[model samples]
Target: MASSASSLTGGISAAEWDARVNLAAAYRLTALFGWDDLVFTHISARVPGPEHHFLINPYGMMFDEITASSLVKIDRDGRKVDDSPYDVNPAGFTIHSAIHAAREDAHCVMHTHSVNGVAVSAQEAGLLPLSQQSLGVLASLGQHDYEGIALNADEKPRLVRDLGHHTYLMLRNHGLLTVGATPADAFVAMYFFEAACMIQVRAQSGGGTLRPIPQPILDGIKQQIGQVTRGVTPGALVWPGLLRRLDRRNPGYAD
Candidate 1:
């Protein structure tokens, strides 16, 4: 593992190596949580530098199988910037690139085609405020209409427009997206985003009237979250424990 880690980090800056480790952990954690859709979805992190290069999972590899060394580095155009042995799914990079190019704060962009996320995205009401988890996301959420398979570059402007300054994005009839200053931020944000969807789906299935959180309470969620997190990103507080969990469950992402 040490030898492999050295090989992957050989020429990259320490910042890039750190980004690679975090991004790889995000991928494995996605799979651990059953949020991965084969290799169809993507989680991308901007390479920390002046250039607009990014790291994304290698194409055709299961999310649980991705490691720091295997993630492919690519430019904003989805062109490979590093000579990685693995290929990337440019179509998967479409949403990620659009967000990254538009929002500097979006250091990591995570998209998931998880069952519950897609189910909620397909709903007409779209993420009803039936759960506490929904409140945090509703405070800063955006919705984008699906434009086929996301293979066309023409859809970029519209995607960026819909995602303007928001942390969570629901792709109508598709899935969910979340962006953050780091992979930890994005991963934890998606956790709440997907949790809300899961609760919504189950509640609807119970065939009972859903009690929505009151608007007055929902309006104050941002402040409430700030207090809860004490002005720190939620990920900053949560990531270390998450890494410990990952180490016990699915080790080797760093390699």
Candidate 2:
């Protein structure tokens, strides 16, 4: 088995190291916010190397428990090239790889099966624009039908097509996924997406007629979010605070 420190530091540039730390921080925050589904879901970031390789959590580790050193590096074919005792989740990679291979802009990808996310996904109407939070996510969201288990290589093409040019994706009967130019961007997108789902579910449970946001107002809000949030990039102002919180709770993810 590869030593944790060597596997994480070896062959990784400073930029890659930064990415790994940020992605690891995202996993910790996601778990903190109750978005993790134990060891079931994943998030991945492209390593800043010639091979276009990526890093993902070791299969058995819960998101909260994933350290930067515990993340596994793998090629596009999902073969582990790093020395680690843990195995990679092939199904997790299938969804992430589809986007990374197809969209050069996607440097990081995150997926979750949180209760609210899956609940909204199973709804026939899917993510109604009932709240401001939902509108923020809906403006940039795309939907893809769930194809049962994502183990088949053949599903990559369709998955890529469905996620075309969108940052957030609602997997029908499955969960939520988001892509970003950086790990922070992906995490922010998922944060908003998950919030939207949670709000929708809670509102629906109140047993009242839903009031959808006006289309013109919704469009305006979308523009405002883009302008104010600066293209919805996650590294904006919120990420640093999140990282600090992680450090306080769990310290460095690198082992």
Candidate 3:
């Protein structure tokens, strides 16, 4: 982890600093929950300054190894703007930058390729609303077919078009992606999404009839998430606890 530099002290605002911390915490927690794919998938937050920059994990670091200071700041073009020892992954940022640039409502975007997520993505049926956990995602999910590799700049427009107005998106035959008004919202969305995939995979393995939640009940589930969560927004409420968990397991994230 890089030591905090006094020269860069006043560059990022308080709000941006908080966003960086929460995004870094989410990366560590994703690793803790066994959702990371070594160092492949990424979670990013928009930097809070005038440049409309964003923060992403350094290319070579494991998700659990990401720290707030270690996170690389980059322009929408995926060029590193900060003087860090690490390099940003341009290919990784291609998908992330598209969403952040198009959606002002999205402050944080998370992408993962956990076994269950990719397993379900590979399935012809995709996510089945067979469990209560699945309803959370079904309420506002979208699908995007896989294009060979996301590194192509030409693919950005299509990717953004497919993700229009949806919180959860299954990248068919690829993995799962979620966008949030805040980092916590995005994380919670992915949590339910990954859980749904796990349940579906397990249920399929049993070769038993799958009882799915009715479409009528989905509204109620969404309402409950909004109500019980105190309208605090999913990301804001859970982010602090995630940070504390990281602090206990690997305190270097804040370094």
Candidate 4:
């Protein structure tokens, strides 16, 4: 195991090592939030290469136990690019690869089946801006109809079409996906996306009138996020705290 730890960064670029650590952390963080669907859903970080390589969770490992060395590197065609003990989740990564290939800037993509996110996705109306959380998501959101478990490679183009240039994607009757320039950015988006969905679910349980945020307010949310985050990326601002929390509990992911 120590040999594996030392080899985690072996033969990888400095940037790729950083991506692995952050990606592994995102997987653990997802588990910490109860968003991991037992290794079913995926979060992929694009490796720095012209072939559009990505690092994904080794199939069968629970998210909490995922470590940097265990992540599997694969090309966009779902073929492994490295020698690792685990196999790649080709079917699962199809969703991620489609997004990574279509969007050059989306270096990381996260998908989740958290109860609230899937519950809200089932609604016909989808996410409603009943709270500020919802409003923030509503400001930059897209939706895609489910296509039977993401097994069909034929569905890739349509999925990419639905996700065109959007950061947050609500997979109707499926789950939620968020794209980002980095793993931290993707995790932050998923955190807020899940929070907004959870809030919507809880608020709907009351069966009372739902008040939507004003349209004017919705239009200004990008600026609002900028202001609230002080012109710095919200992910960078909040990621250190998340890492600290992880260090207190499960620090092995960084290896």
Estimated TM-score for each candidate: 0.97, 0.95, 0.94, 0.96
Better of 1 and 3 by lDDT: 1
Task: List the lowest-lDDT window of 10 residues for candidate 2.
Answer: 1-10
Backbone-clash count (model 1):
0
Candidate with the larger TM-score of 1 and 2: 1
Tens digits of per-residue lDDT for model 4, 1-255: 222757766677888888888999999999998998998999999998677789999898999999888888888888888887787776788898888889999999999988999999999999998888877788889999988878888999999998888889999999999999999999999989999998999998999988778889899989888989998777999999999999998889977
lDDT of every model, 2 decimals:
0.92, 0.86, 0.85, 0.89
- The C-alpha local distance difference test score for the whole of candidate 1 amounts to 0.92
Cα miss at 190, model 2 (Å)?
0.7
- Who wins the lDDT comparison? 1
Off by over 4 Å in 2: 230-232
Q: List, residue by residue over 17-65, the lDDT tens digit for candidate 2.
A: 7877888888989999999999999999999868989999889988887
List where candidate 3 sits over 4 angstroms from the true fold: 1-11
Better of 1 and 4 by lDDT: 1
Work out how many backbone clashes candidate 3 has. 2
Error of 4 at 169 (Å): 0.2
CA lDDT for candidate 3? 0.85
Residue 28 lDDT (model 4): 98
Query: How far in Å is the alpha carbon of 157 misplaced in model 4?
Result: 1.2
